[model samples]
Target: MQQPLAPWLEPTLNKLLAQAHEGQLAHALLLPLSKEQGAEVLLNRLLQGLLCLNGNACGQCKSCHLLAAGTHPDAYSIKADGNQIKVDQIRELTSALSKTAQQGGARVAIIWQAEQLNHAAANALLKTLEEPAANCFIVLASAKAGLLPATIRSRCQNVALTQVSKAQSRDWLQNQGVDWNTVGWTYDVLGGPYAMLQQQGQERLEQLQSARKEWSNALAKGQVSATLCQYTQDQPADSLHVLHWLISKKMGSILASQRAFANRLSALISEISQVRQQLAHMPSVNYVALCTRLVLDYQQAAKQ
Candidate 1:
């Protein structure tokens, strides 16, 4: 029989369970999950199972019931307020950890979008990380690890989760009662299950497809200013993906196209890399303006 969670969950949970079984689980862990993977749900189940008095998640004990009800006193969470995680939030979380475990079981702290932690917040978190409490576990979930501070990153055991194959995603969608035919743009835009659910349904998918087509066409025409303003309105997080795709396409065309644009492909690739690097620090920059400038710079580079 299929497990309660996604198939990919097995490899990750199994590794953790084995470690916990052998009493080797580290105090802190960093789970870098792909954009589409449901890290939150998986972590919940893992925590519930970990806290259950029984070896298995009987879902009957007080701990399991509290977890299912989302009232587990030992479980803590911190998420980005806007583009950044403030220092105050980190302080609050650390203070919460100082208190003894509510049920005298393992205490857990989960940080969502860990890459959003600013310098001060990250530093504050590092203090607790350097000296974790006994029987306490800290789980930081991130879409990408490079955005995090190197100091904080070095302390945690890193677990990377990649995108599930297209076939696996398609099958999962089918099981969720979604027809593959209806998944045209949603599937492509989301790249996996959680995103599919977030961006699902009829009207939204249509809008995404329309936005993508228009953006692609404008980008190809070297109309940078108009495209930038348009993207400012849509504000899709996949802008980096679009830039990379365009660069790849232009590079592939270099061998055959007599378009007479000398070193144009090379310039585009350079600009894309710079913009992508900048995107990782969005908390510190005016993101909309930066995106506009990136498009303008890319167009200027192409013309040269």
Candidate 2:
């Protein structure tokens, strides 16, 4: 059985359905979603609604069956080959979209992580975005929509998904049999209900909490602990996120009385962000040294 649409996503789905009902749905849609949101669930619901013969995603129709079986000729999904979506992938998509829908209904194409589309692939998709075929819909879903070229973003209708509130997320997690008290901090770090749930079972919450405590103790002692350094080395991305959160929290607490110290913390936070960006785009960058430098910087700020 298909899961129901997430409570937070229901409104967006309703709006899209209403648009489709009025034949006012755009040819291209840009969905900016974070990991915390139920992007996959929303995407599935949207596609089914568009492809369903009854216009309601009834799940009983032949079109729904084809979609469920992943054999729907008119529905196409594009994903990054590795870190990037190549020009060839976009070319193949355009070729398939040029043909009429085999099911004689709306043809839907979804590009997951559309921000990962390389320059050539993005360029190739421009013409299709500018002039789509009849009954064709292109959906570009990206966690970092700003990374996509302005030209591509300008051509598509931006659909902003509703962010789930902390109260709503806590209630939902509790309903799912999760112990909110134990996993609440995970939610704070991830800022997404779905992401928190995914990481909960993997014991990431415990690791992060431990790291936070260790870092706090080290900050108090005016030194970076070897264990904390090891943790950062092991999990560079998670460590950086935790570090950012910790420094931000510290900065906020001291912003009123310790302006100079807070300013230093703020600078360290900015440097951490730069290191994160460097690691993301340039994997060969020396993250270990960067992480150590950030920790030392945090210690210096704490001493002041």
Candidate 3:
């Protein structure tokens, strides 16, 4: 079933629906999700609106029924298999798109995490995006659009989802009875309350707090190995995000003598950013080694 759209997103949806009504809807779209937004949720909502008999995705029509059942002939989705979206996937999609809609209604295709598309895959898909099928809407969504190939991006209209105010996000989450402890770290990874809701539980909250403290103490005492050891394969990305946010936040508290290390700090930030990219996009990486090297590098840089 389609979920309710976030309030902050309503305005954006309204604008797009208006364009859709006016017959100005672009066949191809590149949407970069706001930090902390659910990429899947946004994609589904957009697809719902596109496929919905009514502009609002009323969820009671034949189209909505097919969509909910995952058997909609005109509805298509492309997602990463493991870490990459292969060329074959794009080929299959393009082939299917060439055909007429089975239900004789609007057709919609959404590529989630489009940055995961490999070179061949992106190029293959770019051709179709340049001249998409009539009555078909293709939406490409990613957390970072820059990671996608320039050619593929050039052919799509861009829609960047911006973050709502922290206060507004807090109120919304509260209304949902969400139990996101700290509430602030909900902003980590550009995630919002809905994302943090997945991490609820006093036990999980305590674990996160302990990890954050460990990260802080490790940096202070130069316990790089021990801190790096804390990162598990199951949640390496989340752990790294917390540590990065913590380190960045504590950078301002450096001693006056360490103020001259600003350049080094900036460099470490860039390195952390690169590491994040690696952890997210590269498959089969030894995260332990990567985390250890990154933390030790930051320590050495801070001392210099």
Candidate 4:
């Protein structure tokens, strides 16, 4: 067999290979792995092995070398640039799938963050999944499997990559020469082996932490509306956390919960959903403005 790539994924790799070896593999494989779980690396390696001409997982084969060089003709990958995976991209992939494999073997297509597909794109891809070509494989990787269509999910073999032990991850990082001081919270932030080695700038993490703190303080001060809006706008991505924090704080005040805090939390949660819906429609919305409004509204509701 070809030398194992990503020894950490050897078990999963072996399981998949055994299926392939038995000629009982499914056309679609849904790998629901977290961002830091090294899902992408596993996806690439799996495709490489499938495409290897020797049918033996040989990394030294001509096809394997092409994959290492990032020039594999039969392997394709798609990822969202900013927003959703557009219908055109899926259409193109579907058309490409119709053609015979360049290596005259397996045709592999991978979609990163596949759940980011918009309604139209999802529909476009559904047709292909329903009637895939012979010797073709589709891999969809996402952190949130709930976001994908149930129909699509039901058709694939779902493989969830769970969190590895923190001690094991830390040990692996040390072996990789990661500087813990400079990379403080990297483990908590990235969550695994695939994400540990990534270099993040000191300032960005600090800025996000500062924003979270400031937002927390403002909520405690009973600031509602405009000020809350400002905080939300400044940290749009953290909107979910901000709302959750408010709910947690209010939960302690049973009297407050009885008074009106519960209603406020409910309303804020609804508003948060609306904000996400709006963002899905118009991604260019002012993040600061949106977040500020949400925070302020929740603050006002809590006081009642």
Candidate-wise lDDT, in order:
0.72, 0.85, 0.75, 0.71
Ranking by TM-score: 2, 3, 1, 4
Q: Please provide, for model 2 over 59-111, each residue's C-alpha lDDT reduced to its tens digit, 9 standing for 90 to 100.
A: 89999999999999999999999999999999999999999899889999999
Q: What is the TM-score of each predicted model, taking all chains together?
A: 0.68, 0.83, 0.75, 0.64
Misplaced by over 4 Å in model 1 are 1-4, 209-232, 235-304
Model 3 CA deviation exceeding 4 Å by range: 1-4, 33-35, 81-83, 179-181, 202-206, 216-228, 231-234, 247-304
Error of 3 at 154 (Å): 2.7
Superposed Cα deviation of residue 66, candidate 1 (Å): 1.8
- For the record, the alpha-carbon RMSD of candidate 1 to the native fold, in angstroms, is 5.7
**CA shift at 299, candidate 4, in angstroms?**
20
Deviation of model 2 at 141, angstroms: 1.8
Candidate 3 per-residue lDDT over residues 50-91, each given as its tens digit:
888886789899988889899998998889999999999999
Which candidate would rank higher by TM-score, 1 or 3? Answer: 3
Q: Candidate 1, residues 1-304: lDDT per residue as tens digits?
A: 1124777776887778678657788888998756567676577666876677673567898887887788989888899988899999999999988889887777888898899999999999999999988878888988877899889889999875645777887787778776777554456545667677666566656555555665566556645455555564455455555555555666677646644453665666676667666655665556456555655665675666
lDDT of 4 by residue, 1-304 (tens): 2321335667787778778767778999899756566676667667867888876658788888888888988888888857889999999999998998887788889998999999999899899989978889999988788899999898898875645776666666666676655554445534455555554445545554555566676666744445445645555544444455445556556545374666667667676667656665774676555555655776687667
lDDT of 2: 0.85
